[model samples]
Target: MNTYDPAALECLAAIVEEGGFERAAQRLNVTQSAVSQRLRALEAQVGSVLIVRSRPLRPTHAGQLLLKHTKQMRLLRADLERDLQDLAPRSPGGARDEERISIAINADSIATWALDALTPLARRNLPIEIITDDQDFTQEWLRSGQVLGCVTTLKQPLRGCRVLPLGAMEYVAVASPEFAKSQLPDGLSAHNFRDVTFICFNRKDDMQAEFVARRFGLKRVSLASIFVPSSEGQVRAVAAGWGVTVVPELMAAPLIAKGLLVDLAPGFKLQIQLYWHSWNLESEVLNALAEALTHAAGQSLVA
Candidate 1:
């Protein structure tokens, strides 16, 4: 077995995190030449080019694998340190240190009930770095080791990861009362879809389009559309009568109840099943976070 150098692994991780050798050197408090040399030595030992050396440097397949290992080791070491600290005697007035856990989550969930689920962790002074993407796509972040866990639409567990269903988030097609009266007077149909504008979170978001297609039976229907990337902004834009949009039921319910927005299709709804995916590590923090999130989801989401 080939022995891996810890320093080299640290250098590789820093390079990827900082996006270049010079920046990595700055972060590692080393010279640029030193960073380059360590990477060369690591690649030689592993017999693979770990980094692509591109603008905004990227990790190769081998580099990503090693990076994943490095991150997992860091988590385990942090857990061990916390355990040891619990057993050690604390000095008077010693300040507690905060630890960070990275997670990937969908914008809709973040805008809805996910943040509430994480309130317990925040209260414990544990910092979380959230990477936001569509639930359908967050799985890629988990595969690349960018996050320790994710709330995604994918039910299949990744290798070294465990998954649990968190229930489905229901969405309703809604628009401002005025817009609904003017554009969807006859309700959502292929006839009026051409005149009605649609609001999309981003180009990658196809939920609104999918809903239109499913309800109207037009697979390739084209309508005037506006891109509003933020989850709250999407609701605000629709509420301002910019266009009709689909919003999570948890968010839309209040607006609909307040008469600020009207549900275009009352009986029809879009349901997205959410799953929590996390590294299968025996760490108290990870398990606690999962439990808190699961409990919150049970209360907030539909069965």
Candidate 2:
């Protein structure tokens, strides 16, 4: 088997994560020329282009494979650190930025149960990076090897990965009391839903349209959208009477009870089943994360 240099692999990962040679050099504490030289050596070793020189740096297929290997190495290091902590107070060098584990989670989950799930690990000073995207799209991070795991809507496990059911998060449509009184007095119905603006997470979010179509039995539905790009921001916008939004019932509950917002569709709730997908690796850190998330999710999400 041909062995590749670990430093060269790390150089590739740093370039992609930091977005440029200069930044990668700064992060790695090396000269820009050294970073470029390392990358050139790696590409020559692999006999393929490892990075696409785009507005934002992106990894090629071979680059992604190497990156994943690098991450697995990082996980192994974390395990070694934990095991050695009892014998030695601290490692000679602390965790590096390159060792930070990354995961993709939906913003709704992040705004609700997910942060609580991650609190224990964070408190222990586990180096982690949370990347938020729409739930339906989070699996792409796993597929691209950019993240070792993700909380996503995809039920099926990706190749070389394992999946665990995290239960369903219920979604409900909500608006401010004044907005409800003024724009949807009788609440959302087939007859009146089209009359108001719908606040969406982003252009990629179709939850608003999907809920309307499912509730009203429409073959196709279109909504007047105002993009918020944030889970909490969408609720804040709705409460300020900008428009209505569909949000996690967990987040909507306290506001609804406080009269800050009103449920627009009483009987219409959307249940989004969530799943946790992780690489099939025997890593203690990954297992601990899964345990924390699944335990917290069990308490909050609907079965």
lDDT against the true structure, each candidate: 0.83, 0.91
* 1-303: candidate 2 lDDT, tens digit per residue: 669898888899899888999999999999999999999998998899999999888999999998888888888887787777678755443668877889999999999999999988877767789999999999998998888899999998999999999999999999999999999999999988889999999998999998898888998998888999999999999989998899999999999999899998897799999999999998888899899999999999998
lDDT of 1 by residue, 60-118 (tens): 99999888877676667556645675577334333221123678999999998889999
**Where does candidate 2 stray beyond 4 Å?**
89-94
Question: What lDDT does candidate 2 reach at residue 207?
Answer: 92
Error of 2 at 213 (Å): 1.4
Please give the distance, in angstroms, between residue 266's alpha carbon in candidate 2 and its true position after superposition. 0.5
The best candidate by TM-score is 2
Error at 181, model 2, angstroms: 1.3
Steric clash count of candidate 2: 0
